[model samples]
Target: MIEMIEIAPKVLGLRINGKINEEDMEKMLSVCKAKMKDEERIAVYVEVEEIGGISFNALIEDLKFALPNLKRFSKKAVVSDIKWHEPLIKVGDKLFPSIEVRHYNQDQRAEALKWVQE
Candidate 1:
């Protein structure tokens, strides 16, 4: 399941658990774009309660959504308990030095949100 955990003007927060399908990815992209319209730079906080693989169509949608917004977001904070998730996100930082995406341990979720707001 996916939920909008919080939102503040130009900032958006999301929580996702279990497997993510193409519909979830599409919905998330729609919500994010709709909420962030007219904003030049966006901040996002994503809390992953659990990690599961995405569907083939979801993977395609994810790439489509992310590639366009790679430099549009000022900060992207990913909160998760899984240590392995860090490596996956760090690759984005390497690819896009303009926008840095950080991984926060679940306990540091508040800190992650604060950094995103900054």
Candidate 2:
């Protein structure tokens, strides 16, 4: 499951708890795109509760959405306790250089939000 919200004027918050299928991903992207219609850049705070994989179609859809929004994000904070999340996030940093990606442990949710707000 994917829960997405605009925590601030231009800050997007997301919580992923289960497998993210293509339909959910498409909806998430649509919501975000609509929310960001007038804004050139945004900040994101994501918290991962469980280890979930994305569908191939979801990945393709995500890239389609991301391609045009290359420089749309200013900062992104990911909160996850999973060990592999760090390396995965690092890879994301390489894929989307527009945003600065940082990973914090689940215990550091407050800090992560604070960082994203900055």
**Candidate with the greatest lDDT versus the true structure:** 2
lDDT of 1 by residue, 1-118 (tens): 5677665766778888988898888788887897668687788889999867788889898888888877777888999998888888989788888887899998998798888888
Q: Candidate 2, clashing residue pairs?
A: none
Each model's lDDT comes to 0.83, 0.85
lDDT of 2 by residue, 5-94 (tens): 667767878889988889879788877787689677888888899857888999899889878886888989999998988998999999
> How does candidate 2 fare on TM-score?
0.89
Worst 10 residues of 1 by lDDT: 1-10
Model 2 per-residue lDDT at 52? 77
Single out the weakest 10-residue window by summed lDDT for candidate 2. Answer: 1-10
Runs in model 1 deviating more than 4 A are none
